[model samples]
Target: MTARDNRLHAFRPDLADARLEGEVSAERFVAGRPARVAAPVADVRRAPRPDAGLNTQLLCGDDVLVFDEAEGFAWLQAERDGYVGYVSAADLAPRAADPTHVVTAPRSFVYPGPDMKLPRVRALSLGSRVTVTGEAETRGTRYGLLPSGEAMVLQHLAPIGTVAEDFVSVAERLIDTPYLWGGSSAFGIDCSGLVQLSMHMAGRDVLRDSDMQAGALGTPLDPGPDHSALRRGDLVFWKGHVAIMTDAANMIHANGHTMTVAREGLREAIARIGYLYGGPTGFRRP
Candidate 1:
């Protein structure tokens, strides 16, 4: 076997890091088979608090790769994106998606049956991998893919590859989801809350609040006016507000006015605001 095969066949290391300070939430390991995050009120340490109740709040496909049930924290090295924080053992689930899952955009959904009329059961998130179980009638609107080798109809794109794409995919779902200060649930989310939630869903551990988030991302790219080269997922900082860059020219944020997640033109929004901290200190992948 080659190096890749050797790595996969090599003896497994301990993943004590993946364990958190709580009870097992879901099912446990079945030996030879991969492990699953225990379901219940398990504490996901060093993890971004998604909504509160805290039982493995946000789940991510990325978590599986670095998930070392035998270690303290699973370290996932991104091929493109950088590194993220750790996730407790209870938050992750089995990699049900087969390598064959497909999507239309970064984030998408799948139906239980080929018939659109059939009630859709499970909703697959971004970066989910699965097999093409069966083909559905080309409705020209909905798509289909197999999840974990199981047949299913899909409507939208099943995001695959790259941590950056996965983060962006999860971010889009919050669009128009509504904004709330200190809110972290699907019901409501604030600016930093948006970033924190999005990152958390993508398997990163980032804190809430603009200042804290600013410190967490990295150094500010610029120190003064000149917010021109802002990339997608970049943090747009202000006096009391912060937003996630949806694109180079647009951003999505939860503000007091909109009180929900909404899109804004980057330059237009920046120009409209009086104070602009164009200088981004740094960039944080997680």
Candidate 2:
């Protein structure tokens, strides 16, 4: 698909957000006020929507520092595990975050209904690759971030491929994964996740994050027939994302707004996500 800028913002709050379930411990949270505590514990959860400090997700356990109380969010550092995001006050646990966690296979569960239970989160198929960044406890179950940037239960999975072929083969499985923010699974994925998983399936260790990925591949070529002759298995990369080219003018990838794996007009998808959509890092193949 030709690269194009999608104006819509795909930054949906994590399922751990208060919309689904009451903010439980371990659900990332922020505070509207900075209430001084005698001493913070590693497992201390914050009160719902603390009206004082901003607890942004940081690389630490439940330990959070009060940044801006007016921001209605607190900048928090995870003491148990360091990964950060904004959490609303209503759900902030004034105590230690919970350890109930779940992870996704390779591709699974694009969207979980508001009423969906947690244990059933694993009903989807196991993905070949997994990354546990975010966590949430719904009802009595734990859900973690799927590679697709969604939420799912932990699971076991098999390999996708052995080398570059694996990237091409396994990616073929997500021909329709929807585009999602922070998504990295087949159920819903973003541009970067598609590239990362494709490479992972091939048994080729590549950087998982998007910006870092720009430097992970070998020297890139221009997106044209003259540039080493584009192949079906060649890689098409942009500033913050990548895709697999199935033809000289066609490619497959997950877009945030599109929210699905799709074959886009090669130059167009590239132009949209690359030149127009905060990308243009270029393409590469191994």
Local accuracy of candidate 1 as per-residue lDDT tens digits, 1-286? 2222211221223321223212223333222324333221123333334343321123233323443344444323212122223445455555554344333333343455555555665554433345564555655544454543323445453444324446666777778776655555455566776676567546575654566666557556642345566677777777667777776678778777666678888667766665444433344333
- Write model 2 residue lDDT over 1-286, tens digit each, in one string: 1111111111124313222244343234333232222111111223324442322211111233342333454333332222233444332444332322222244344335322442343333223223445666667655565433556543322222324445666677777766755554455566766776566546565544455455556556666554437877677666556777776767787766466877777767645664466645567665
TM-score of 1: 0.48
The 0-to-1 C-alpha lDDT of every candidate, in the order given, reads 0.49, 0.46
lDDT of 2 at 13: 41
Which candidate wins on TM-score? 1
Candidate 1 regions with alpha-carbon error over 4 angstroms: 1-56, 60-99, 102-109, 126-131, 138-155, 162-174, 180-213, 216-219, 223-234, 238-241, 245-251, 264-286
* lDDT of prediction 2: 0.46
Q: Poorest 10 consecutive residues of model 2 by lDDT?
A: 1-10
* Top-lDDT structure, candidate number: 1
Report the alpha-carbon TM-score of model 2 versus the true structure: 0.46
